[model samples]
Target: MKQRLEADKMDSAQTVSAFVQTTRDKVSVINNKLQRLLDGYLDQLIDQETYKQEKNKLVSSKKSLEENLLTLERTQTGWIEPFSKWIDQAENLPAVAECGTLLEQKSAAKLLFGSNLQLSASEASGTAQSPWDFLQETKNSFKNSEIFADCAILEPKVGLEPTTCGLRYRCSTR
Candidate 1:
């Protein structure tokens, strides 16, 4: 089950990377064309006014493209990859089956059923802290509830417990 979750996370990362790469490639092509256009204008092949207007457009487009590339890089490298790694390493807890609707326990139940689990936004900090610890902390935040769910065990940290005490709660709201 843990292996399957890891594989799913890997698949998501690949999909995100592929999309970012495609965007960057398209921007590169546009930037290249703009550079060539500016070069031709500067050589007096095009009139001064025409050259100025065209160059301005190209420069503006290049700036926006560069900004987009930076944003995508941050999203992919700075967030998704690290979060995926963390999720793969977080600890798992036992799931509790309650009478409430399944949607209430979707995330926790998914963990129990071996379905893919997505790390919550709280667990996605840019830091390199242990994922299992983060998940355990998150689970503890909701420990007052009645719904119980199972989580996977991430590799133990040095001098830490083999598995973290996450939760076993039942929620009344479905």
Candidate 2:
């Protein structure tokens, strides 16, 4: 996963570099064309109207290219680091499940499940689409093991009586 992330980051960097270089080259070509247009107008080789029209077109293209280059430079390095951090943290879910507080666990569930979490009178469950789905599947295999017992439980109940968290409860009929 780390290798894949590094490869993805490298690919993104290369793509951005290529994009910026291409835009700079295009701006250079447009500047040359503008200079040639000015020379033609001065030498009376081209009429005023033709010069204005051609210059406007070249100037617009140059502005667009410059904007694209700026945008690419500013945003290209933004998402990769955060994304890599997320992947690193995601790999430690079991530890988080083992030691994290209830609030932390719920936050992790929110991150993993997004809007797929559901709460009702009997259950608080996240959809199976979570990246943790494999963990859920294997949990039953280790149910009897002391180290795995707590982590194996996925859903918590939503009950009429609230717990300290104010929403969840662990209850069974007497």
Candidate 3:
């Protein structure tokens, strides 16, 4: 996703830069024309009124193009803010899930699940919204899989062993 966004930004920056170059080329042409007009007036090849009128038009056009160049440059960087914000939030999510206070966890859950949270069958169930839904489905799919059979070994000890604790992990023939 980051790569995709970078590619998009590169493509747009190239387009904006191309336009700026074209505008600059036009300004260069206007400068040349203005210089020629002055030479023509000095050599009596054109009238003073005509030269003044032509110069004014070129100056006005050049100013407008310069302003547009500034605008294009300013707006090209606007994509960074949203991208940075997404990165920050995504990176912070796991930490919040693990150790953040109950309020923080609730806020994060609501952010991900929206109004889809539920307590069906006395189990926490929800349809995660949009992108997060895919991750939630992935987690659910792995919940019953035996591939990570050792994961429970890492669960922190919390209290005295319950009567059912030994019942869950029994030696069985494969």
Candidate 4:
């Protein structure tokens, strides 16, 4: 599985690399043409009006190609490892919350809270990110609602087994 993942990553990068090469080649061609155009204008081989028009078109093309190349380069797969590590850490957050060490809890908090993490008054508090924040909002809304106030365990009417209740939530590897 690891080998396949590595191969897939390489394949994805290969496609981007191929396109980057093509774009670089196009840019090089444009630059060469531009230099020749300048030479023509300087040598009086081309009129000023014609030189200006051609230069404008080539400059526009070069700028666009450069921008595209920059974007493609920025999208490289260098972030995959760190993101996978983060996912692993995130999946273990429930365990961290349950019985992990203080350092582990701090790490988990920072992962969930991002830059909003704050340590004050002997307590940690912050705005959570994404699904966590959504989960908090859902929990608060439910806790404040009258419909679920008297209810703790949600029992099925006829068949299903009762599951553990409360706002207790856990993160899963999936």
Supply the TM-score for candidate 3: 0.55
lDDT of 1: 0.56
Worst 10 residues of 2 by lDDT: 165-174
Candidate 1 displacement at residue 118 in angstroms: 32
* TM-score-best of 2 and 4: 2
Quick one: ranking by TM-score, best first? 2, 3, 4, 1
| lDDT-better candidate, 3 vs 4 | 4
Question: Relative to the unseen true structure, what is the Cα RMSD of model 4?
Answer: 12.6
Candidate maximizing TM-score? 2
> Model 3 over residues 40-145: C-alpha lDDT tens digits?
9999999888988998998899899889888988998697778766656666888998999999988888878796678978876677787666556545767787
Every model's TM-score: 0.42, 0.64, 0.55, 0.53
lDDT of each: 0.56, 0.75, 0.74, 0.76
Q: Give the TM-score of candidate 2.
A: 0.64
For candidate 2, the per-residue lDDT at 51 reads 92
